[model samples]
Target: MKEFHDIAWYVKALSKELPNDIRNPAPQRLLGGLAYIIVIVACIVAMNKFDINLVEKLMFSLVLGFSFASMGLLGHEILHGTVVRTPWLRNLLGGIAFAPLSVSSRLWIKWHNTTHHAHTQDEEKDPDAWISLEQLVKSPKIVRWVYRLPLGFRAFVSFVSLSFTFSMHTMRMFFMYINEFKSKKLVVWLEMLIPWAVWFGLLFYVGFNKWVFMYVIPLLIGNFIVMAYISTNHRLNPLVPINDPLANSLSVTVPKFIDVLNFNFSYHVEHHMFPGINPKHYPLIKAKILEHWPERYFHMSLVKALITLWKTPRVYYKETEFLDPRENTAYDSLGNGLDINNIKFKKLKSV
Candidate 1:
């Protein structure tokens, strides 16, 4: 296994090799932002203007989900301040981009930038951290069944799980801060409310079926796609104490189309290592990583990786193993079998 020193030395070398033009250009940001807006508007205009049938609307729902996911990922880049220069402009763009998902930029920053980035694989702090075997073992039957669903269903479950988690987390935080009237909290509360207000008003105008087909279903699917990236990115990785991106992060090798749509999220390790680096420069950073680590760096195509995760257990049993707590069996990320029952649980912590 590579130690912290190995990662540190690589990072130092990487910093020296990175080009001065690593930041995204203004034209690229403007064109990309405009394209995203057009796609979103086109989807909405189609739903409103055409007398499309249910089947077609369902198909459109899938497209709409993809569109929203694309926008959400762009918003991620905007929030990172890698897509533009001015801070307020970046925040404004981020708010507009995430409005479709009803996720507040402030709330997302609190959870993602402040918490998850700071403690990527720490089970106790990172909300996206690995699930613990012992916690899954003690979970109720229904909960276990949800986790034990068939591969295809399990993939869907992973997506929907994130949708519910984010929604509930936001609501919990909102209520917890209800009494506080600080300007930032108030702004965040308003930002959180605007999307829902527009949505509910539209629901009254368009009726339930139209709203579901055009908005809700697609929104859920979009959330799922986002969660799909989040879940598979770090699956079966160790819960380490060190802030070594190479050790804890797993980058997915996605196709160009997926990279475009996801704003190069598959280049996750690169993003984590240099948070300020823009998506356009990910390929270059990835090349640098490959030059140094070659065979040691982790990456896989999105679909195959998700399928592997679905087949493998979600509960971490050891450094490179996961336990199917329901069956009391162990498996690697590739679905290879192992006998981990003899493994002591004394050191295992709650998820």
Candidate 2:
């Protein structure tokens, strides 16, 4: 069995061919972020005022679900520095976008920007890799059953639970960061307090039931959609070794309509290789990659990918020992030393 370090050379060689100008324009990203917030606000206002019949509410809810889920694509763009030039502005916008969805911008930065991006598909290092069902079979029966759902439905359920999932992960990362600082824990307390403050404020200003109907329900629907979309992006692929990040991730060749709505997140392979690249540039990158390295890329239609995942017999995990500590250290260090300050938007003539 080859050790994990033995695979590092393969990953680096694959990534070396990636194009440089994969990022989107800053102004478009800002507009995209603002558009999501505006759409959410509009939906909330429409829901409150329309006094809609049940059928209408259902339609409204579907729209809300789609819009809310789509925001994840927007949030990702912001994270990549494609949404805005200023880091502070990006953080503020990213926070607002994630707040209703119950994700923390600060925490997402650490896990996504620092951890996942740096370590791509290394199962040991990348939390995004598919865990093998064999491991689940050895565990509790309930765990096995939960892991056995139809791919689409399972992905949908996971999407609905995203807020809770992200919140838990964020809190864990938050404490880890604070522990590193050895700082007093006022920030966590403040985070807890802010929600209550807003909840009570809404309850007092509007009626309690209205608060639940307006904010909580919409947020729940939105989060479900977000999670579903995210799961659709990468979860169904066969697990690869921790060192083989590219293989662990797959891309969906979505139709233009869904692509527009998803902000091109279906281009998963391209996104992973050049995360700093904006969604706006994804299609261009995809075209270029296909033109250059068609055989190397996995290009499946969205429906096909979902069907493939649905039919997959089992999620496989490749277990390999790492003989070269230096290689692991090198991959880990690549993302740790990111020059976040210099990750600003710059115009590139071509891919």
Candidate 3:
């Protein structure tokens, strides 16, 4: 990884400038959005027009599912400003990308961009932190069992349960808004209700069961794929200290096949470090960064990672250090300290 330390030297010595074309992100956003629309339309047409057997339905479902997953990945890029030049443009595209999936853009922005990014692997503040093997060892037996299950399966279930998941968040935000009168809370309601209304309205007014089946089912499946991809990429890794983004995030050296399937989200660490760079530019940035710090990077194929996680034995935790709400930590938000003690629960109870 010493090579990564030499990045500044290389940049200074080579003094090479990247192409202006590489900086133009609008085209990628347009292309990505178009790809999503085409795939969705194709799936709808197939379901509605063709007299398909179970085998065909299964195959088409997988194809459409993977396509929807890729769409979500592209939508993530837009949210990070990787696919567009303007925030408004990215927001517009992001809204479209999440509409079918029934996710809240506002909630995603808060959880992913704000909380997760700021805290990274901070067990106290980062909701996405890796619960350590030692911590797992001390956990209750049930906690150990749940953590031991294949993360992919857990992710699949979570994806299928998105409607319930976001609905709860929506309700929480609704009450919070009512209590606090914060305008930001209103954005949450708008984000959730508008998509729900549109989807339900279509089902009610159009009377097209095929559209519901084609678009919504595939959308949920795609959401599952995205969740699986994310869990495999990061959750099982050893927890790094909150301050260290490099150690906390994983960077898999995926083959071209997987990269194409995932929209190149495999380079997660590089993505975290240079979030401003678009998804299309991740490969370029990763190559440049790898030239500097190879050892710091971790690469595993998706299949290999999944298999290893499945084969691993359960490790549970009982008690881990968390930011005390009374303490002065960097995680304090708006005079409110992060209350890690509140996180002491056996399992994430299903909503």
Candidate 4:
């Protein structure tokens, strides 16, 4: 693991190896962005213009939801200024891209770029990191059951929690942050308000049920898709305080189509190691990483990675272990089952 102890020097060396022209490839960005937007617009138009049956309508809504989630990913790139050079244009594009999700780009940048990126695996600082199982100590019997399910069942539970619940909670977080009275909070306010106002106005113009099918369900599904992909980003990594991208982030090997749809987001480690680099170029970065540090570079296929996270409890019992709250036991970071009585977690400095 000391291979990454000198993370800074390694990163500098990798930067030197990248071509001088290394930048976000405009074709990938433009093609992907436009395709997602076209999907959303086409879904809306089909729903409005055609006399489609219920099954067709349902299918269209699902596609629309997937499109909105894709747009959210694009918004992420825009906020990073990878979509275009001009800051104002990037912000404007971000507003439209994230509008369906109702997420404020300014708020997301402040939280994700500043907080999550800076403190990736730090238990105290990365808001996206695992929380304590103690938070569930007083939960109801049903809640405890949901928390303790095996991999297959837990995956289903995650879909429900993420899709139905987390989306609204995220918007509330945006509102709460807006109340902080920062100077740029107004930009976030407008970003949050404008699209929502337009959506609601359109919803009222259309009937209630149409609104529900067209926008609300899609929003839920889109947010759920985002969460599903995001959960595997760093969830399986050891609960360490250090910021070494190699040790704390994971690259999930997925189909090429998924990479295109997600804007190559499965290259999580590459993205974390070089956040400024366009995701389209991650394959180049991946080649460099393997060439330079073949023994240190790690990746898991998408299915296995998701299953591991599903089976493994999310709360950290130690910096290097996960707690299975149901059994009151600890497992190593790699998800190996171990007996609680035999484990001594005090060796962890990060704890």
Candidate 5:
């Protein structure tokens, strides 16, 4: 077997064989981003103008929701320098793309681009990383029962939290890192309030009932669309101290239609490999990785990743062992976790 090294070593090797334009921004994708925004706008306008029933309203809301989430990934990409090189233009367009969720582009850069990416799956460091058994013990009892347990009541409906949890986590991270943004607090607050003002203004314009369908319900759907990818992105992978994209990131295959809608964000391992690269080129990156490091790179279907996540305990006892403290049972963190009887309870050495 080849010796493992940091992600940079792999990137350097991959670049030699891949096309030179792989890292270049796809500005044309910005038109697609604008189209997504138009979808959100059209949905809201039609909801207010037409005498649509609840069923019709909901159908429109679903479309709006997907557009909101889809634009979100475009914002995520632009923030990563995927499309625009000019910092001002990048942040401007990125902020617009993220406006539906009222997420601040600047804060996203600090929270997601800087911290989360820097510490992909470090238990102590990655804020989005799942809890450890020791930490789970410290949490409240109700949380232990109701939160994302691999095989309990949580398994049934905790998935819905994805609808709003991504934005909630984003807001929480802002206050959580208040100290770091203290100097630039004004810009941060201004950016946050600007998008929120437009949204809230629409709430009054549309009135409460219409606003629910227009903004609130659609945002929830949007959150669900975005969080589906987020939940499957790194949470299923084993936590690692060393930053190894191949070992720590799992890229799942979605149908081509879904992939196109989300800007190929499913090529998550590729995104981690080159955060600054255009995702339009992600398929090529995937080919190179599979060609050179098939043994180390992890790939699975999106459905399987979601199923494995639903069945596995969220708290890790060891790097590879997931523990549900109530039963003192250890399930394989990276494997199918459906059958409790098949679970091996011993703690394996962190590999």
Candidate 6:
């Protein structure tokens, strides 16, 4: 198979054909996220004003959690340079937006927008890419358990892991990848401090029981919202040496209301194709992608994507083959079963 190395030519051609609005900066769309922020504040106010009971607090926390996650996505768009190009304002808004998960906008840009986007599914460079079976075996026992507990054998219980995966990875990237961005360390410290102070200070002020319902659990919920998409974004695709949005990314379809709430985030491949473009215009871009590369694009329901992710092993034996080391079983990148067992992986057919 001929590898295209990069999609620069395709993007260049498509750029000329796209509507001008796709390139225009629409900061106003980000303003909608303010409503989520407002709702979170409102939830806090209600807890104090009504002296809410446990049941009422639970309801408010659910709203707060969803609002936190939703607003964070808006911040994602902001950080992506989709709108608001002012350096200070962009980081400020992004910092606040990602507050629920205690993510530093500066570090996030380094980890996500910089590294993850550049590397995509590159096995070594892309932090989020699935590891090879050899690498998995070399990993610590606890790390192996981490994969198996949620994404490996008993995958049905993965939600427990997903709820905090974003939070875990954000800190992991911070501690692990901080050396790469040492110059920004000071700002990242301030960025990281803001969320911890707000959430923990609120906890001490409001009491553990109250804080757990209001902020703690809500933050966990926010993490779940973020990871649910993150997990499905690229894991199903083959780990290519080069970045190929069509082959290395999968676009999950959400319902109309979710598409609106999530800032059109379900259009994963479209966003990867043009991360800087306003997500509002992603559907149009998606249409253009289909027109150009119908066979290359991937779109599926959110539920189906999650189900398939659960059924497959997290370790890669081949670029397109997933394997469970314990079972000697093989599945394709998309979780379709392969009929080979106890056979050399080289003899296995390409998915």
Whose TM-score is greatest here? 5
Point out the higher-scoring one by lDDT: 1 or 6: 6
Q: Which parts of model 1 have CA positions greater than 4 angstroms off?
A: 5-10, 24-27, 134-183, 333-351
| TM-score versus the correct structure, for each prediction | 0.84, 0.70, 0.70, 0.86, 0.92, 0.91
Model 2, CA-based lDDT: 0.55
lDDT string, candidate 3, 72-148, tens digits: 67767778766765766667777777776655666666667776777665566765555544555577988666654
- On lDDT, the candidate that comes out on top is 5
- Which stretches of model 3 miss by more than 4 angstroms? 1-26, 130-181, 205-212, 313-351
Candidate 4 Cα outliers beyond 4 Å, as residue runs: 1-7, 24-28, 133-156, 179-181, 334-351
> Which residue pairs in candidate 1 collide?
none
**Location of the lowest summed lDDT over 10 successive residues in candidate 1:** 338-347
Give the Cα error of residue 40 in candidate 1, in Å. 2.1
- Which tens-of-lDDT digit does each residue in 86-146 have in candidate 4? 7777778777788888877788777778778889878768867766555455567787677
Q: Is candidate 1 or candidate 4 better by lDDT?
A: 4
Model 6 misplaced regions, further than 4 Å = 1-5, 144-153, 334-351
The lDDT, on a scale of 0 to 1, for candidate 4 is 0.74
Runs in model 5 deviating more than 4 A are: 1-3, 140-150, 335-351
Q: Tens digits of per-residue lDDT for model 5 on 66-143?
A: 889998988999899889989989889999999888888888998899988888888888888888876776789887
Clashes of each: 0, 7, 14, 0, 0, 0
- Write down the worst ten-residue block by lDDT for model 3: 326-335
lDDT of 4 at 218: 88
Higher lDDT: candidate 4 or 6?
A: 6
lDDT score for candidate 3 against the true structure: 0.57
Model 6, range 250-298, lDDT digits (tens) per residue?
8999899988988888999988889989899988889898898886777
Show the colliding residue pairs in model 6: none
Q: Relative to the unseen true structure, what is the C-alpha lDDT of residue 19 in candidate 6, on a scale of 0 to 100?
A: 75
Model 3 lDDT at residue 208: 65
